[model samples]
Target: MLTFEHDYTRLPEPLWLACEPSGVRAPKLIAFNEALARKLGASVVPDDETLAQWFSGNEIPSGAKPVALGYAGHQFGNFVPQLGDGRALLLGDVVDAEGKRFDVQLKGSGRTPFSRGGDGRSPLGPVLREYLVSEFMAAVGVPTTRALAAVASGERVARQMPEPGAVFTRVASSHVRVGTFQFAARHGEETTRALADYVIARHYPEAREQDDPYLALLECVTRRQAELVARWMSLGFIHGVMNTDNTSISGETIDYGPCAFMEQFDPRKVFSSIDEGGRYAFNNQPAVAQWNLARFAETLLPLMNVQGEEGVELAVEVIRGFEAHFDKTRQALRIAKLGLAEDAGDTADTLMDALETLMHQGRMDMTATFDALTHYAEGFDDIRREALLALTDQPEAFDAWLEQWRAAPLLNDATRFDAMRLANPVVIPRNHRVKEVIDSAMEDDFAPFHTLLSVVSAPFDESVEARRLAAPATDSQAVLRTFCGT
Candidate 1:
């Protein structure tokens, strides 16, 4: 028997709306993460038929208390006072065998007060995309929400056209967001303080021991966001939307709408069809994260210091730390990717910058470029170098960076191949490949989707057949824009 706990209900009543997921028809199991289910300590895994019913919100489990969380976000630089979980329901928290707590929620469950006159359901494509990408992120060691199960609703939703409706079971550290603090701040000082205390106790227990716990919480969240976004940039993952509400206070990547991995490396890449001004572009992620953190810091001011100006000054100091933290983290990542030692820091940075310049100028495939370097480290230099040189119009620039890297003392390491393999994944969820999955699923064929998921699950492992997935898309296969599918 699984016990469901309602720790979130202890918060202020206005923070959420008590509700149950609207039932779906003919719910059928699409995919299940059996490993994750066992990790969550389910003694008996239900049959697929029964599992689908529970995940689709057609059948409630024992001791479940569903609710829709409330929050406010600055959407594309404009503050929206109210935006919350319109179609998602927090079923309850489940404690794993390892004693870690995770919120188990059903997205596309149904309508709630927070729906804001919109349909509270998710399209099939987005549901599968989130499941695939989130699990892929986890496999690659990125902190992100995990997909537990996906269920077909036997219903269709109208987006750009008629699309199948589906429900996704998501497991997360917590659903709390920077916008949650923003919501508390709107209610006044006491509410914000209470929220700070609660978040500190739940996520940052060390903060409670600090002389100024709220400030510590601010700094902790700041550093985590810095590290998280830096990793995203290193992996060429472009989060199309970085709104305050979508920015998880827990620092795990959440809300994978319109998100994509770049085929050709470009700092100004924008995949979200809705982002007209390129506010959340590939290179702008770190800056946008810092921008969101500033909003978060604004909510912490009342609790940081009694004097208003002093609090603002303190918050500004913490916000400034984001740049230093991001630069250090991103640089360390680049060093590792290039198989460099501590002494090669400057050289690694220069090599990375030069490579990025060459890639951008030559329109090189991001994942392939990194993957080829791993082969080069494994002593396949001649073939890999020739292949890489063929892709670049700026052969001189590429040759220059290669020469600098070749001379670095770090190249003497005997385990360079192992190190580079760990740093560079063999495969990512390519846009063309993911589109292939969605197109097949739309035709009620899920073989392509399952195969793609399996390939991405072990990103670092090298397989002959899987190497085909690493290939860059052709001009006809390129996907320029991705939709929210709301």
Candidate 2:
């Protein structure tokens, strides 16, 4: 039996709306994450029939207190004051055998007050996309929400065309976001402080020990986001939508819609079809994160200090410090990727920038380039070198960069190869491969999806068949723009 604790629903009435998931005619289990289920302390597995009912929201589990969380967000830089969990309901918190707590939520469960004239359903494509990508993110050691289960809803939702519906069981540390704080602040300072105190108690108990608890909370979140975004950069993942609502205070990657892993190493690449202006491009993630944190800080001003002006000054100081923290995290990631034992200072920056410039100029595949370099570093392999050099427009330019990289003092360590192996993943959830999975699943063939999942589950390992999935997209397979299927 699953046990739940409704701490979020215990908050003031305005913070959320108690609701139930809309029932579906038929529920079929599409995928179940047995490992993740075990992690959440499930001792017994339900029969397939019952499992489908529970996950699809056709029947609620015992002790579940469902509530739709309320919040507002800045979508594409436009403030939408009342946007919230329109199609998701936080089922409640479950404590695992390890004594850790997690929130169980059902996305595409149905509409709530926040539905905003929308159907409040998720298409099969996005559901499979989130399930695949979230699991891939977890396997890669990135902080992110995990997919517990996926169930076909036996219903149809009209989008660009009529599509089958699906519900995803999502697990996270907490659903609270930067946008949540903004929503609380809208109610009043009292509401904002209440939310702050609750968040501290639930997520950061150490904040209570600080003289300025609110400021302490801000600093902690800033550090997590800095590290989080740097990790995304290292993996070549673009969040696509960096709106305030999508920014998780828990620092986990949330809202998988339109998110894509980069194939080529262009820092300016954007996949979200809605991101026409490239506000949330690959290189712009750090700045967008800083901007979102600034908004979070704005909501905490009242609780920040006794005087309003003092609070503003304090927040300004804290925001300024975010840059140094992010720079340090990003530099360390770059150093590891380069297999450097010590900081390379200016030489490191020059080489890394030059490699990226070459990638942009040559349209080199991001994952392949890094993996090839790692192989070349471990042992001077002519095959690997030639294959990588072939991707560049000017092989001479790459040869010159290689000379500089070899001359760097930081590469003297005997363990550099192993370090690079750990830093560079041989497989990523390539856009074309993911499209292959989605396309096959739509036709009721889940073999490709399962195979892709297995390959990405061990990203750093070598598998000959998996290498096929790592290839860059062909002309017909290239998915230039990703959509937010709302």
Worst 10 residues of 1 by lDDT: 404-413
Query: Whole-model lDDT for model 1 versus the true structure?
Result: 0.89
Clashing pairs in 1: none
Residue lDDT tens for model 2, 337-446: 88775757556667788899988888888888899899888766788788779877779988888878887766754788888878888888888888888888788788
Over 4 Å off, model 2: 410-414
* TM agreement with the true structure for every prediction: 0.98, 0.97
Q: How many collisions per candidate?
A: 0, 0
Model 1 residue 145 CA deviation (Å) reads 0.6
For every candidate structure, what is the RMSD over all alpha carbons to the true structure, in angstroms? 1.2, 1.4
Taking all chains together, the TM-score of candidate 1 against the true structure is 0.98
Tell me how far the alpha carbon of residue 466 in candidate 2 is from the true structure, in angstroms, after superposition. 1.3
lDDT tens per residue, model 1, 374-471: 78777756888887687778878887778877888675558887887787899999988899999999888988989889999988878875798878
Error of 2 at 98 (Å): 3.0
